[model samples]
Each structure stands twice: as structure tokens, then as C-alpha cells.
Target: MIPTPAFVVDEPLLTLFAGRFEAALERHWPNSILSYSFKTNALPWLISHLRNRGVWAEVVSDHEYELALALGYPPERIVYNGPVKGRERLRAALAAGSMVNLDAKREVEWAAELGREQPDAGLAVGLRVNWDLEARVPGESATGAAGSRFGFNVENGELDAAIARLRTGGVRLAGLHMHRNSRSQSVDVYRASASLAAELIVERGLELDWVDIGGGFFGSLDDSPTFDDYVGAIRECLVGAVDPARTRLIVEPGGSLTAVPIEFHASVVDVKWVGDNRIVVTDTSRTDLDPLFRRRRPFAVDLTTASSATVPTQIVSGFTCMEDDRLLTLEDERELRVGDRLVFRNVGAYTMSYQSTFIELPPAVYVRDAAGAYTRVRERASVSDYLRGNSWLSPES
Candidate 1:
């Protein structure tokens, strides 16, 4: 039997979502590339599977870039993006024909240096444009007025300055990247972003090889904007500016692709009453469910082999010593008893990628096949596993 505090991935569901995304892109914009965001969930198995399925890797760090390469993602197929990409790796990616988007000032300097060093190499790079999302969609941005810390601010002269630097350095920009984070994840977000890209391309008279709209769209959710909705909105905005025949559209999806197919299963270990509150302790911790501790609501959970009796209120707490480790409170639901398994759903994104070892190590993860058979992908970590890279003093010392 699979132990509690383990994760199970629904392989069929993942495959379905992948196919749906590809089809949506094909339907709305045939000349488009779908790159899976690696920072969202960089499980090697998951990345390799997506790589095999013709999905490119969109990485934000040098480690993720190398991970993609290690997993057989060709340099050209990988999208290198982020504000703090190492200079050596950036140069390597650019030389190897990867799509490197210049975000920070240091990156522009590196790009310029490479352009001067290899003047005949045709160093093509993309510029990440930062704009005010609040102007287009009020109150839709996560950081309303402060704006995102990523990309070059276009409202100011930073973006123009970066462009001029690249042009003077004899480097040709291949495309423009306009990826923004939004609070609403609405279709209007993509529409506004694409419109900005279109306006910039027209105003600057840029002949681009590709136009990346970036990724923050809602995926596979009821009453939420679908992939078709997002792609259609973007295409509408860019159709007049860039020809679909020459300029390829690109999207980097992270949570939208991985959120629904995985679940976290934890078993109830003990139940106790303190004063007027009933506390049920489990093997899982908040570190497993919400590593950022951002969720104010309870996780979407399913109880297995639970008692039929209803409870007015019971606090579902984690095994950690931290008092705030309480996950959620069950209200008027089936009474949870010892050995009852609680499966948390829609937790595929950021949970595993951002998880850290604290009181307990990371749990094992299994992938469920179409036949409903579970195969362990990652074993439960042990002390020895955690101590793999650390140096210890000898007993004699």
C-alpha cells in the first residue's frame, strides 16, 4: 500500500491536458510554440515526459537551463528567461541558438559584448518588455502600482535604451517578450499584453521572427478562460501587426498545465480535543500543501474511508511543531478518524517545486498509469539522502 504523506500523479490527466494545450494552439495559431515553464514544477520525469511530447522547456535560471539540457532538450528548443541568468550560461545559450530574452541590465551588457566578440555569428536575442498592466486592466495586476520587477520598464526609457544598446552593438533582436503576472488571469490580460506588443512593434518598426505573449492564463478550469480564449485574444491583437506566416507566437505555461493532474495524500494519525477545539493531526504538513503559506482557504480535498458521522468543526493540523502548521478546518463534513486518507487536489503547481525539507523530508511521489496501477517515481527521502552533499566531522574529531 502507498504510504500516507505521498503524492500521486494522474498520468492520463496530464497527457490529456498536454494534448488540449497543443490542440488549442494549433486551432487558434498554428505557427506557435508551447514551452513548459520549468520553475513551476521541474520534476525530471515530468520534464522528460513533456520534452518527449514536443514541448519546449522555458527555464528561468541557469540550473533549470542545464536541467533542460540534461533532460535532452536541444539548445534551440529551450527558452532562457529571467532577470538573474548567469553571464556564461547566457552567452552559451545565445551562441548555441537558444532563445535568450534580455531582462536585466547585466544581460544587455553581456549580449552587447557577445555581439562585438562574434560579429559574424548573427547573435539574435529578444528583449523582455515591462509595461503597466494596471493601465490596461485596472486592479488586475498582482502588484498594482509598483509594477513587476522583471523585464525592462517600457514606460520609462529603459526598454528603448536596451534596444538602442543592442542595435549599436550590431546585434539584431529576433523577437519581443511581453510576459506579465496578473491577479485575475483573465483573457483581457493577454489581450492587453498582446496589444502592447503590437503597438510597440508598429511604433518601433521591428521586424520580429517571433512574438511571445507570455503565460498567466487560466487552464482547464470551469468558467475560467480556456487556452482557445487566450490564444484567440492574443491573435486578434497581433494579427494586424505581425503576420502569422512570418512571426511565430510563443507561450510559456507553468501552473496552467501542471495544477490539476497531481494530488497529495496524507493519512490522519491522531485526534485530540483541546479546550473547545478538536484537533486532528496528520503526517502531512503545510510545507507540502502550500510552501509559501499563501492559501487562506482549505485545499480541495477528498476523504477516503472516513467515518459517516458529521463534525461541526475539526482542525486539520500537520505534524510540524509550528503552531501555525494547521492546514485547514473541516466544517460539517465526515468525521476524520485515524487511518483516514485525505487527498488534496489541484496542488500540482509550485508545491513540489518549492518544497523544502524541514522537520520531515520530502515525501515519495508516484505516477498512476491508465490501468490505475501506481509506480513510485521518487522514494521517500531519508536522513542519509538529506546528508548526501554535506560534509560531517569524524567521530575522532
Candidate 2:
């Protein structure tokens, strides 16, 4: 039997959801491309499976870029993004003809030199565009008040300066990428972004072969907009302004597609009464659920196998020394008992990248098939595993 606190990944469910989202967008906009965000969860198996199913890698680091290349994805299929891009990796990505989106100001200068070096080719590049959407859209700002420290500032003429440098240095500004991190899952936000992009192109009299409004579009959430809805919102703004026939559309999705397929199961280790309220401690730590534990979560208690369900008001926490390790406080009065498994949904996206080696590391991760067969994909951590890495580890006891 697989150990407690192990993760179960449903590969088929992941593919199905991702495929539906991508297919709908592609149907609406034929030139649309969906690139899976590698920073979300870069599990080799997950990346390889998605790659086989026509998803390109949207990587933020050299490590992730290298991971995609090692996974047998062609360099051209990988879209390199992020602000912390080193010169070597950026040069490599440019040389290999990967779709490279410049993030910081220094990156623009690097592209200039590279462009001059490859004069015959006239290097094609993209700049991650960011404007003060808060001032323009008011309450609908996607990047929020503490504005995104990413991309060129359009209002301040940094964008114009960057464009001039590229054009003068023999680099062709073939694409404009605008990715905003929005807290709201509204279609109006995306529409505003699209509209802003169209307006910018018109104002500057610039020509672009592609427009990537980057990811953070609401995924398959309840009452949230669908893939078609998102595309339609963009089309509404872009239809008359930009020539869709000449420009390709790209989206990089992370939490939306991957959140549905994996479930974290943590066995209840101890149950106790703190005054009148009940507290249940699980064998697992909440660190594995990074970025998800920020709000009212989407996890459930598996009551089928549990012998008793005596708890009414329960506070669920993990086996970590960190004081704020509580994951959920069930006010709904559900039945919970010792050894009962707390199954958490919407956990597939960031778990692997956030897996912790806290007081105690977790067990092996298991993958369940459509036929209900379980396979061990990742091995459980052992003491030797942790001790092996310490330089002080020696046989002298």
C-alpha cells in the first residue's frame, strides 16, 4: 500500500481539461498557441505527457528551458519568458530560434548586441509590455496597485526607447507580449488588456507578427469565464484593430489547466479537543499547497473508510512546527476521525515545485489510471535521502 500523505495524480483528467481549454481557443482563433507554464509544475512526466499532446513549454528560467529541451521538445516549440534571464541562456534561446520575450531593460540591450552580431538573420524578438492599467482601467487593474515590476513601462516612453534600440540594432520587433497577474477572474480584465494592446499598436504605428497576452486568464472555475469567453473578449477588442490573419495569438497557462488533476491526501494523525472546538492534525505539511492555502480552499474529507465521524467543528492542520500550518477550519460540521484522509482538490499546479523537506518529508507520489491501477511514479523519501546531501554526513558515530 502507498504510504499516508501521498499524492495521487490523474493524468487523463489533466489532459482532458487542458485539451478542452486549448481546443476551444484554437477553434475561435486559428493562429492561437497554448504553452504550458513550466514554473507552475515542472514534473518531467507531466511536461512530457503534455508535450506529446501538442502543448509547448513556456519556461521562465534556463533550468526550465533545459528541462524542456531534455524532454525532447524542439527549441522552437519552447517559449522563453521571465525577468531574471541570464545572458548565456538568453543568447542560447535566441541562437536556437526559440520565441524569446525580453523582460527587463538589460535584456533589451542584450538583444541589441545579439541582433547586431547576427546581422544577416535580423533577429526577431518580443518585449513583455506593461502599462499602468490601474490608471486606465481603474478598479479593473490586473497587475494591481504595487504595479508589476516586469516588462517595459509604456507610459514613460521606455517601450518607445526599447523599440528604437532594437530597430536600430537590426532586431525586428515581431511580437508584443502582455501578461498581467490579475486577482479577479473577470473577462473584462482580459478585454481591457486586449483593447489596450490594439490601441498601443495603432498609436505607435507598429507592425507585429504575433500578440501574446500571456497567461493568468481564469481557468475552469465555477462561474468563471471559459476559454471561448476569453478569446471572444480579446477578439472584440482586437478584431478591427489588428489583422488576425497576420498575427498569431499565444497564451501561457499554469494554475488553470493543472489544478484539477492532482489531489493531496493527508492522513489524520491526531484528533483532540481544544476547549469546545475540535482540531485534527494530518501527517502531511501544508507547504506542499503553496499559493493555494491563501484563501478558502477546495479540499474534501474522505469519509468512506473512516470508522467514526465524531467531529462537528474542526480545525485541520498539518504536522509542521510552523505555528500557522493550519490548512482549513471546517465550520460546516463534517465528520472527521483519526486516520481519515483529507483529500484536497485544485492542487496539481504548484505542489511539486513547492514540496518541502520540513520536519518530515512526504512519501512517494502515486498516479492512478482510468482503469484504477496505481503506479509509483516518485519514490518515498528516506533518512538516507536527506542525510546523503549533508556534507557533514559521515560514518564516524
Q: Please report, as a residue range, the 10-residue window in candidate 1 with the lowest summed lDDT.
A: 388-397
Give candidate 2 misplaced runs (Cα > 4 Å). 291-293, 296-301, 331-335, 383-397
Q: List the residue pairs that clash in candidate 1.
A: none
Worst 10 residues of 2 by lDDT: 301-310
The TM-score, computed over Cα atoms with residue i paired to residue i, of candidate 2 is 0.92
Global fold similarity of model 1 (TM-score): 0.97
Clashes of 1: 0
Q: Please, what are the lDDT tens digits per residue for candidate 1 over residues 65-142?
A: 999999999999998998989999999999898988889999999999989998999888899998999989999989
Position 334, candidate 1: lDDT: 84
TM-score, every prediction: 0.97, 0.92
